[model samples]
Target: MYEMNVEDRGKLTSNRTFLVKNITKTMNVVDKLMEDGTITDDLKQDIEAKLTDNDKNRKLLDIIPRRGPKAFKAFLNALVKTDNAFSAEQLSPGAGAIYKVSMTSSEKGMVSPEEEKPQNQHSEIILPKKWPTEQDFVKDFIVKTCSHSEKGKLQSDNYYKMRSKPRGRVLMFNNFVAVAHKVEEEDGLWKEKLQMRDGTEKDEQSLRRLFEQLHFDVEVKKDRKVEQMRSDIAEEKAHRFHKDADCFILVFLSHGSTEGIYGTDGNVLTTDEVKSSLNNKNFGSMTNKPKLIFIQACCADTYDKGANVADNMAKDMSDARKSMSALNLNDPKLENVDEADSKVEKSPSDADMFIANATTQDNVSFRNTKFGSWFIQALVYIFRNYACQTDLLDMLTLVNKLVSEGRASDRDRNIAVAVSVFESTLRHKLHFFP
Candidate 1:
């Protein structure tokens, strides 16, 4: 095995104080170090537990020298990749100079000697070019799709009025950690534990930014129990802001079952309760206005083994026929047009509500610890790019397309895919006109 270089050790030791103070993205660096196999999960937890960035950095520095031979190099690379290049420079000036020169050359489209060298293509599976992060992908997608100038005017008759100063009030409930509890069954009391969601904060941040840009007043409630969530919803419903708002949006990011979303306390909050609480009868001010609910949670405990497009067409058609038959359109009750017209006169409490779940019924949603849920990522990206022009249903369709096309892997290396599902009772097209 290669030995740790004394020179690299010296660089880290010499600039320990400077690195501790200057490294801002310590978790990112920790993630990179862990990915490189330079640091173990235990060491990563130790670094993350330090409470402050400086403390985290100090913990990281303390661990690096004791790690394997490649640790120092990996740490430096981590710093550079995580936007702490200046700290990397302080640790090793020569490495910093090389990185800067490489970056500058890249910006100017001049390939370095190292990059010009041919690689053994047979040794690796070359993936298609992709953005380094979901954010970068979204930014690039938006720039390519949206024109800087406004393209068309929206007639009020065709679209919902979305011109209120603060177009809507958005309430987001993000539950990262589920509270462990015990279930008393016929056998005995069994402990139930849920894994903490790692990348949900990224989803929350993306959504907050997007909605704020869309001119909505946003409120985020983190790790709330069911009753607390209900209370917050009640308060939101009673808030006078709805008088001036054109729409309402509720977002839930949590672990869930087909029954409903889970609170931190492990208690379930059924989607029906959520809708009933905010229905037009309960929240009269929003009558006829759009009420959009976006849920990023697993609806069930199953994975989707996606089918080949060509082979699945016949099966899809058969399923469609079954579904249509189940609808019983031929029933004599369905032939009463006058009855339907009379029913339409009494507006349903759930009218104008749009509910979009991350995955279809009986399928688990996919979440990336590094990025976020595939559904929310695509939703934010598509909405940010197309909301200025596209209607809500069309935008959600794009979200469904983008998310379903994404692939995720489980611990067993099983490839899984997800498809977003939405149910809309929207009476008119809704556009943010951002």
Candidate 2:
């Protein structure tokens, strides 16, 4: 039922609010299903009237029960994707309530059944023996039905007969790296007009290229709010990708605090939120894969003095917008590249996960308005020259060495990087060799 109309949109603070709470106690979408398993006439009318490319939407009786209410919610979200990606078209799950090949569509966003792509025999997803909720299945349905090259009937399976070869994907969610200041007046008029993060553009650009060179399918997003960030790390797209990829690399470059990173809105988003988004328990297929979260933000509010003690560090989690110059590696002496071609046996159990922070909990780091932040530059340098030769930790060690030791032309501050190796499953060294 349309418990809350468009005019009531502002009062909504949660999905619960959207589905319940009319003074009349009238059944809302939240209580969409009555005891008899029938839906409100209002909702049924809404679904039926919404036609997709001249194809009538399937009857409501056919869409709901097969996947349950959560699948219906998934269908709601799918509609939004369709509206955004195509010209406001829609489709149903199918007439028979089957999970796959149920909907038929000619629109850019809706999938047709005959065109459905079969999943690879090796395709995988991490899940508990019993699902906690129907919503989770909805998310999985969306991911399983999509592919890299196409939308709607997108192929979830990408065959890889040679699973022994090193395989992985790098996902980049670096947004609002360069956000202008926003101000709301007493009258509530909002204004924005200034670039705050001068060097982050360079940081994102460099990382994207570096990962692509390493054969990682690089995906990037910029200037997202808190919900967008949360949806990203915890959603179907990212989770599904982990099923086949051997390693998952996340590079986040934005204003952050000791507690968590900041969304474009400047609110704190905790690191735990990030860890849960890619949790192994939730992602069974990724239990044995190496999950690396590379954070180029500050974990402390204090600054380090030149006395060379790490007790005091430098750099605000805020944007380091001093200079946009090219990266400069002091290049004292290069490490020997003898171990670049080595490989170790892969682990198939739940392990091999860690997080890399640019600074510890009490110190600050430095960034140049011209050359991006110090940590990101060091990361690019180490990966470009050493990933093929060194293991992941060793390369990160080099990253720590360079960032903590180098002096910036714009700011003369040095800080140590932090790494939390939550899991030690990498029995052998990692190589980005072809």
Candidate 3:
């Protein structure tokens, strides 16, 4: 390990505040540093002991300067490896280029030309390759998905028309707190106490920004009782603007069970009731338009113990089968309602609706107190980045892929994962085209 120079130490100290605020995925950085022998087990525990990401990052910055020469470089490498190359560049102007050269050259069985050059010859700095920002990622996907050939292949009549001045209205019900109540079940009587959903405001903000960017008139109702929620839904259904809109979207962020969502008063609002209220008979104006619903809450108390796949074919197959067996598909009763109408029959009331749940039945969805629910985070991110090029279904699929790969911890520190599920009845493709 090469010794970290005085200049690098100075840089780390001066940029402490910026690093603390921006270094997300802190555990990944800590793990890499530990693997590189830049930090001790004791130090790792101390860093993890801090409750928030900022505190953990502060601790990490404090410790690295004392870990000798290799610590600085190892920390920078970890940041770049964890999709934080922007931070690495901020710390050292050409740090990303240096790391990339080292990595790509190693794979090619050659030394980096930068490393081979004489010390004095490094006076001219090589500009690092531009790393994609969050907005850049969104733009790239839009450009790729809207290419001439890709757009040409789509049939005009196969997609829902989304060209309205304001595409539609979105109603979001964010229940951050629930009242305490005693309930009786078949098993026994139990007391239900719900805690405040911390960090939920962040999710509300994200959703508002996303929908507004997509040209939707967004309304958010927070901490409403069951009756209030029902009344709100009814008002939306009767709103005159629906006659000029292309679609409707509803979102629920609250504590819930397989039966339904919970209101701030601890009253249960059954999922069936929600669907029935938004059916063709009630929301007549949107009968043939798309109606989308997103629920971010736990379906049950169970945690998903994710499986690991091995390189060996036999072991991989065994893991795959075990995973398949563990999955429980909890399909809603209204999910299969037919959208096609014959001369002698009427289309189902639930036609053109798409329902998305954060997790499968009999599992709990994970949330970060500092960020938000894993499901919502992925949903906002994918929609923001891929909506221009991807249809609604494809965007939700990407959300599933992103959420399933995320690992979280329960109250007992057990490793838990989540998988998002969606059921769609729309006959045509739904695209935001934002």
Candidate 4:
């Protein structure tokens, strides 16, 4: 049945090319043998001879060490756990077949006969309804017959379980309160604050400590323009990752509005712009990879009004809306629009974007007089405590819960919050420490 046509066989002469071609062919052949039935010693010897014909093939053989009958059976059992075992089309589809094997160890005992079951079952117990319990009498004989017919016998039911492994690449991007803007305007004379009352050497130092512990390649930039921020993003995107990179994280702690963050000149830079700058042609492609962004910025539309006379009034959504409307009227010219909409308009469905906004559109993002930004503090705390033990989404959920429950003065009561998860299933829900 195995006839090689003269024209197709004539092309391969070089050892390297032949090695590659035959290795592929051998994989297909082995796949067919596995689907049809067990692989015998004679079949293994034949394949080994064909595979070892070239030096490159011989080296590949060493890399994928040849397994004996028991090992091969165990390997087959292992594959069932990882792949759709029953989906492979049987090579001898026309022939009558019996005694289907379960690939995974966990499912092995479930498929066994009544005699194979543990004797400690209760008197009221009935057999599983899938197959007839009367058929159990012939199972041992059938299994023994198959074992004698095939060279390889099935190993013990239990096999080693495959645990999750670590991916070695680390991603780190942190932005401190880097905006340098003119706050006081008197007769066109601009008064600048090099650092805001909340900003100082200690903020950046704390961030460096946290990120260093996380093993991030930290690079601190001061007072960057919007375009300079884009350039930094481009440079960071150039950091190469292996094919198995588990997760990526980017942290921005700056002065910002509902729609966008601020640059050095007080010009607004949108979140979509930041994300696009990292994904452009200048930056290396990161399609289908998990890209996490944590923003700690002031999303407040206007300065807070003094506490209401009735401090303990039960505020509903309507009250919240009224407060938001009043705030908007106070800052009509300064209200930022939907910056993320433009990107969505361009392409409705490009996944791998998860943005963690610091607050709801109406509320203000918080900054501490002593401790750095409130959102940043919550983030650092959660990442330090939970990032290693739980999934990123779960960890962030915990952060949001903690931040909302945190105590604050009436003047500074707006706590950190977040929303929006695009293509949730496609996300890599990994815990870096786990």
The TM-score leader among the candidates is 1
**RMSD (CA, Å), each prediction:** 13.8, 18.4, 14.2, 21.5
lDDT of 3 at 411: 49
Candidate 3 runs further than 4 Å off:
1-155, 179-192, 310-331, 334-345
Comparing 1 with 2 on TM-score, the higher-scoring candidate is 1
lDDT of 1: 0.68
Clashing pairs in 1: none
lDDT of 2: 0.46
lDDT of 4 by residue, 1-434 (tens): 23233322232222234234223234333443455444454655555655333443343333222333333233223223223121111111111112234333443322334323222221222323311122221111111111121212112122111111323222332334444345667687766534352532334544544454443434566666677777776666766652344345565656666556666656656766665553312233455555556665555444433344455533321222111111000011212245654644321123444567656554555455444544455555555434443445765675556445333333344411222111232334443431
Q: How accurate locally is residue 100 in candidate 3, as Cα lDDT from 0 to 100?
A: 49
Number of the top candidate by lDDT? Answer: 3
Instruction: Name the better of 1 and 3 by TM-score.
Output: 1
Question: What lDDT tens digits, residue by residue, belong to model 1 across residues 224-321?
Answer: 99999999998999999898899999999988876778888878788888877777667888988999999988776677767766654333322111
TM-score for each of the candidates: 0.62, 0.48, 0.59, 0.45
- The parts of candidate 1 lying over 4 Å away from their true place are 1-152, 179-187, 309-346, 410-412
Candidate 3 TM-score over all chains jointly: 0.59
How do the residues 1-434 of candidate 2 rate in per-residue lDDT, one tens digit apiece?
32323322222222222122111112222143432344555655655464541122333323343434344444333333332111011132221223223333432232322124342111221222211111211111111222333221212232112132235666676754433235687899976432366667767766765664455666777788778877776664345566667767777776555666767775656776666555565556676566777776655444543453553335331222333222111001112334455595433333455677766554555556655666776676556444433456776776666665543323343322322212333544454442
Sorting all predicted structures by lDDT, with the top scorer first, yields 3, 1, 2, 4
